[model samples]
Target chain A: MVKSRRTKAGDIGIAAICLLLMIICLLPMLNVLARSLSSSQAIIRNEVLLWPKGWNLEAYKFVLTDSKYTWSLAWTAILTVICTFVSMVMTTLCAYPLIYRDLKGRRLFNTLILFTMYFNAGTIPHYLLYKDLGLLNHPLVLIIPNSLSVFYMIIMRTFFYSIPDSLRESAEIDGAGPIRILFSIYLPLSKPVLATLSLFYAVGRWNGFSDALMYMNNRTYHPIQLLLYNILNAITSIEIQTQEGFASAPGLSDTIQAATVMFATVPILLVYPWLQKYFISGATLGALKD
Target chain B: MKRSSAINRKRIANYLRKYWTLYLMLSIPLAYFVVFRYIPMTYVQIAFKKYSIVKSPWEMPWADNNGFEYFIKAFRNLDFLYALRNTLLLNFLDLVLGFPAPIILALLLNELPFPRFKRLTQSVAYLPHFLSWIIIAGLAKQLFAPTNGMINIALNRLGFESVPFLNDPVHWVFTYVFLGIWRNVGWNTIIYLAALTNINPELYEASAIDGANRWQNIRYITLPGLRPTIITLLILALGQILSSEFDRPFALTNPLVNSVSQVISIFVYRYGIRGLQFSLTTAVGLFQSLICVIFLMAANALAKRFGERGIW
Candidate 1:
């Protein structure tokens, strides 16, 4: 009887913490949304918090109308699609063949592939190689170099390994070749894992900034994240200029920064429901670390 | 013997012919790994050679001081030292503050009775993890900006001083760590939560029968079940002690916070890529990588000595 009452107290305490976490997670983003919608007068006067004050859509209008911003958005969307398709094909190819237990040089291939996951040659050599390959300032630098993720490939290979051997054996007994077996049996059955990995690949490509930061000098080819990074860096310099009092860039307003963040963030945020649904299994699979 | 050799040849031929397509399929990814990944490893010797436009780094003579010039330079350079100090300091703080946040959250979450609220809390928390650091930086500027910043403004209205969250170096480090925790804590709980489900309900029932309180149940059953997962993750995380994701420091840092924010990756970007100081930067990179591997091995060995399953 005493224990039950104690348990109820514990439960309430836990619920309160969860509620606090939800608010912590929710409030700042709502603040960004509020700042983005509020008038510059109210924003400067420090009126906005969780809700808008003197609300307007001028920042969104400015961002949507700007060619540089809109072009990168569209360009990144296209890049995401291309990267996802190419990466899926590349990853599937890398993973499917390795599941053959009796394949020649399997151990060697596995060792070689897995080594890349742990030890990258670090950034200098990677950059130098990209420079030598004539990919510097080229957009293919992003797509080609990061084409195969050994981690994701391992996830796929493990998934492939889990499909029963008897399934493959029956396909082989029917005189289906390895390719036929992979397509008709393995590929068809592996849609959920494939979709999950594809979503990850797409989202990763969409958010990627570092490669472009390092490998390219071309501003026009910058993706949305890179664009935002440049904008953020530019604003820091402005903040230094105005640090004594207030930051007031001519075109880059507080509302505009908030709106830009929303634009960059919303696509991935829109994918959250699907990510919430898919990621638990994906997380568990990746967590296996096999 | 000749007839047996002929039969073996036929068997080899059949094996090769049957699985030829698989090998063909493997070649593309293998080629990518070779060209993009492995070949660069050999070029790490550039750290030892002199930079030249007319000759490759390999063709250039060994650098000053018998090939230890750049390593010494990196250690001695004030900016590099600052970066090293900041990297270790920031990551250590993250290790202290950021590491256990998820485990604690997961434990608290396990005690929560409402399934719907638990799911909603998790979904909301995980949302921030998916957003890019650039987006997070924007959010930070919005809330933490002085004077007009929402949080600072709120504080002022409440008769408190504005916090220099982004402007000051010491506060910057803590803010950076907090942002990191905010981004990762919820998402990280997924691993611990998954581990929690693997613990047997029978243990909980037995503990309850023995009159073990909730704290005691967790102390005995849940934590013990999570030990291997925790240790494995810790060992893996140690490998990344020197090499963090280049994105966060690169994105979240500003000129004011540069002293604290200039990590090794930023060092490499500034000197190697931008300054074209290939020898010095590659030495730093190699040194960073070597230390990372050492930390990883040392951590794994330590874990094994204590009879835990390390990541290996």
Candidate 2:
């Protein structure tokens, strides 16, 4: 690290800019929090700024007890878990063989996977294919179709490459097969990268709702993100109405939407702090190597 | 030659037996690619075919016999052109403006004297990146709503008219671009900060010794250090010039701004999924994929020409 004088003009300037940007970044999110906690009337009146004008959990109560929100949340949680598990397994399996220098057809497999990054069959065909495969409207639609992200596979592969050859060789010498060696040795040694990838997969699967939107026609099958999206639409659509009741009721809609947004967001946010350090390092190193 | 070929075949068989488990592990991914990736590629031919939902994709008549019809139709469609233009324009705007944001943020963050403050700020900045476009869109709608949005409220407080951030076409694009930067700039900085850490400190020391001021040192040393990374990312960004992102656009777009916001991906969704016009939309999707491939190849070539790492 380069040593620098304290309180230099450059330092002050950089810190100030960073701080200002941070506030800009944080303010909207914080405002949502404040709005969610504030009374519906305060929200509609635009009385709440960064602080709650009237504190209440009525909106939160609505979100938690609502059947639509709860069902979608359950689907999203299950989908995230299954998708992450399948993705991690496939990524590991795909990345492992490619690490071996003597693995036949390694270049062919790598090229096949890499080709996908630049080109695809596009959305329509993928949708049609999924439809044909009986994946449409099914929970597996979210999991199987996107199970192997080539980018994450490459990240994991790079991590596997950094592992010493001697470990694998020794394991093999003791009669460990590739599967055995991978299970007993490689997976044990790859905790940080695995955790990083698990978080990536989990977060990605959790936030992703396009699949649900496209594939599932049943509102009951909608994921939490899609539910939140619909809820937001309700909030925005409320703007078009000029009815006297709605005019008086705009605040409740704001608080309800804000509460739903937080309900969808806070669970994922809770997971972030646990894996953030690994996520940072993983992202940085992965991008550099890429 | 015949005898050597037999021996080579036998050697291959022996090698397969020894590492059969590895191949077994790989077979799953290979099968996955074939089923999910390659099969969809075959379906792309439907773009050229007289596609019928009732018929299997393979049963559709090929384009050369009469298939360029949809392609011609797509070209003639004014909406398609608009979508293409909007896609290219939005992506280009992002490339020009949004691309440099993270690099600048990373550089500024690097200049901070206190590590603790820097780390805290970085974490806060990265927070938005984790949010889904759905949540971001919700937050954006709340913040920019014409009547009661926080920004509008502030404007009204200052005795100004509420800006139609979501309704107005031009202002919508501005909001789209700003939101894109807001959500991603911090996350994008991680790579650049990593690149910053890789720069040799001694070079900076040498520059300081030569009486180079901070700006001069940054210009000559830091900028040069970041050149490869900047070029690599720019090349990657160029490849995505046609891919006006689906999530952000889809979530944020309103019926009022559909003219400006109806991008290629959205067009695909409209025609393919909702309109149920498989052939027309597939043609559009194929056209997009072709352009994307061309862009990727061109970018990779440029990177290679500059002696930087090509993505391939």
Candidate 3:
């Protein structure tokens, strides 16, 4: 009975700490949601907290109605789809060959691929290479240059290695080629890793801005992230100029800024919860450290 | 023996012919790595060259080698030094404060008796990990703005000064590290929690039967079990002391705080993209990679010495 009471007290203490941390994570974001929904005057007066002071959907309407925001959103969606498709194809092709121990020059390929994780020629040379390839100012600049992540390839390779070789050997004996076996056998069973890597590539391409900032000079081709980056910079610079803060910038209000940020973030965040189980499995498996 | 070796070679050739499709599949990604990843590595020599736009960096010019001029310029620049200092300081703070955070969180969470409540807390905590740095930086500015941020409002309500959490240089580091911890602690804990499950529950039962208190049980069983994982992760963190997250620093920084917020990766980006000082930035990039390689080797050696898994 004494032990049970002590355990109960301990559980309560643990629960309280966890609850506090969760609140710390939730309150700031919830406050952003509240502020985005609140009136401009309420926001300027700092009246909003966890709840909106004067309920309104003006911010959402402005963000949704803005042609630039809508265009950038569409551009990001298109870029993400193409980039994810290309990345998955390249990653699987690279990963599958490495799974075979008898493959010619396997060691050389492994060393070359792994060398990139340790060293790169940095931004300038990367820019030069993309320019040489005529990738600048083109949508291919975003999609092609970063189509294959070596780390994701390594993870997929590991997943493929986990599959039994007997399956491949039996299929090979039945006169099935490597491509046929990959499409019909391996890929169907490797859905978890495929889904995880596809999501990783999609989310990565969606959130990416550095490459766009460097390679893309055309604002029309700018992803939503780069657009949001410019907008945020404009907002902050304006705030710096005016000590009287939290006011609207031209047609961009505090609520609109909040709304756009939420808009830029919510699509991927929505996908996260549904796919979270794979996230943990992917991370832990990929980070197994040999 | 020679005849058997010849047979082995013939068998290997036959195997390759049979699996030719695999090699065909490998060709596209190999071409990508060669053109995109490997080609730039050859261009690192531009750091040592005085090549301009008229003469492409790939051209192996015979004249004006300009040996180490860009390196000398980069080292002599004040902005480079400031960026270096900021990178070191922020990374050290992250190592000290942020490294052990997930471990502590995992420990606290492992103590929870109710599985449902534990899971709810985990889901909420992990939400921040998925939010991009752009969104986080925006949320951060909103939370810490001097005029009417919620933090400042709370300070005012209590009759305290409204600290410029993001604006002030002194407070910015604290805010930055705090947000880093908040963004990552939950996701980081997943590894530690996985490590925790590997601990033998039977040992805990035996210790309890021997009248060990909760603290003693944790100290004896939990800490030791977690030590290898802690060491391995510590080595990995140490390896990344130089290449801090580029997006966070880039998005969060403004001119007011750029002095303290500039980091090496951002330095590379600013110079390479905006300034177009290609040679100097590549020199700095080389320097950063060199130091990181050294640090990685040293950390791996240290981990191996301590009987933990080294990254290699």
Candidate 4:
């Protein structure tokens, strides 16, 4: 009975520690939400903590209605969808050929794929190549340049390789071509991997900023991340000006910045839980491969 | 003999014809690599040249006969050394402090009896990984504000002095490392937790039969089981020694703390993206990539020697 009580106490201690760590992990995000909703004056007075003070939607109103933020959101969504689809299709197609058991020069092809993972041609040549290809500022530049991630392709290839050879042999005997076998047999069996890859590609494209920043010079083509970057830059500049006493208002800058951050992050955070299972599974697939 | 040779060539041609569609499918990725990855490597020569936008990357005049001139210039730049130091320091601290955090968290979570609470905590902890650096940085600014920040308020309530969390260079590394742990620990923990589940339950049962306490079970069974994973992760982290967290510092850094906050990637951006010094930026990028390649290869070799699975 004494031992049981001690064990119970240990469990409680462990639970408490876990709870506290979770809170610490969540504190920054909660703080952002609190700061966004709190009145600028209340925030400046340091009244906000776990909850908002003088609860206001003014910040959200400004961010949502703001043309720049909304337009960038639309662009990011469009780019993410298009890029994810392109990546999935290309990766699937690329893996299909490599997965064929009887394909000649398979080893050489696999090595060629893996080579890109180890060595890259640097940035300038890529830029020049894009310029020469007339892909500059084109939406396709974002999708095409990064359509095939070799690491992901390899994972999908491994998944395909796990399918029994008899299945393909039977399909071939039934007069189904390679394309039909891929669509009818391999794809259905590969749903988990495809789902995982799709989520990975989607999240990557959604968060992608550097590509837009580099290739898309036109502001119209800017994704949400680049927009957020510019917004942060503007906020920093405002802070610098305020320090120099050029701007009289202080609270407004902080509120706007907080709001912009919330706007940039909240949508992604909302969709994250939906993709969490896939991402966790996908991350482990590499470790699981013997 | 000529007839046999011609027949052999015909057989090879027939084989190629049979797999024509497969080759066509393979061509797309190959084309992409050529255009996107391989061709870009040709431009690395610009590092030795006074590359002009008007002139071609190849046609540009060499700075000197020696290929090391730009490298020397990069080393001479005060910011380069500072950036390199800061990058290495941050990566080292992260590997030291941030590496074990997720594994511990995963183990603790694995011990939880309440499934609902476990799921909730896992979801909440992992939420930060999805947030863009812009948002994380913005949140950091609010929490770490010297006077009116929530952290300062809490400190004041506890009768401690309000710390200049963001501004002070001394605290920069700690803040960066801590923030990294907060944002990434959950995501990292998921991998270990997955590995832990693969641990057979019979071992635990056998340990229990032997009267092994929880601590002993964890030490003898769990730690030993997790060694390979821990080593693999360590090697992966070492491979990324030069690539510091870009978004975190980019967002968190201000003029006051730029010295400690600046990293090689940020440095490249400052010169390459913002300044449009394409040639120099490419040079810096090449330099970083080369270091990363060397470190990655070295770590892989070391991992192989240590009998751990390395990412080859």
RMSD of each: 2.8, 3.1, 3.0, 3.2
| Candidate 2 chain A, poorest ten consecutive residues by summed lDDT | A240-249
DockQ of model 2 vs. true complex: 0.74
Against the unseen true structure, what C-alpha lDDT does each candidate score?
0.85, 0.85, 0.84, 0.79
Per-prediction DockQ? 0.74, 0.74, 0.69, 0.57
Ranking by DockQ: 1, 2, 3, 4
Q: How well does chain B match by TM-score in each candidate?
A: 0.97, 0.93, 0.93, 0.92
Candidate 4 interface RMS? 2.3
Looking at model 1 chain A, which ten-residue stretch has the lowest summed lDDT? A240-249
Q: How high is the lDDT of residue A44 in model 1?
A: 77
Candidate 1: tens digits of C-alpha lDDT, residues B120-192: 8888888887888888888898889888888898899999999999999988999999999999999898889
Report the C-alpha lDDT of model 4 over A1-290, residue by residue, as the tens digit: 12466557777788898899888987877887888888989987889897999898877776776666788789888989998999998898788998776788889888877788877666655776687778889878888898889888877887898899899989877977778888899999988888889987887787777777777878788888877766656645465343322232455666666777887777787778777787666767755662
TM-score of chain A of each: 0.92, 0.91, 0.92, 0.89
**Which sections of candidate 3 miss by over 4 Å?**
A236-252, B1-13, B58-66
Residue ranges of candidate 1 with Cα displaced over 4 Å: A1-3, A236-252
TM-score of each: 0.96, 0.94, 0.94, 0.92
Q: Report the CA-based lDDT of candidate 2 relative to the real structure.
A: 0.85
Q: Over all chains combined, what TM-score does candidate 1 have?
A: 0.96
Question: lDDT by residue for model 3 over A1-290, one digit each (tens)?
Answer: 15767778888988999999999998778888888898878878978777888899988887776677799899899989999999999999999988888888889988988888888778888888887778888878888888999989988888888889999999988999888889988899888888889888998888888888888889889889877776666654366224223334453367777787889878977898888878777777776743
Interface alpha-carbon RMSD, every candidate = 1.2, 1.2, 1.4, 2.3
User: Candidate 4's residue-wise lDDT over B75-119, tens digit each?
Assistant: 888988899999998888988999999989988887776798998
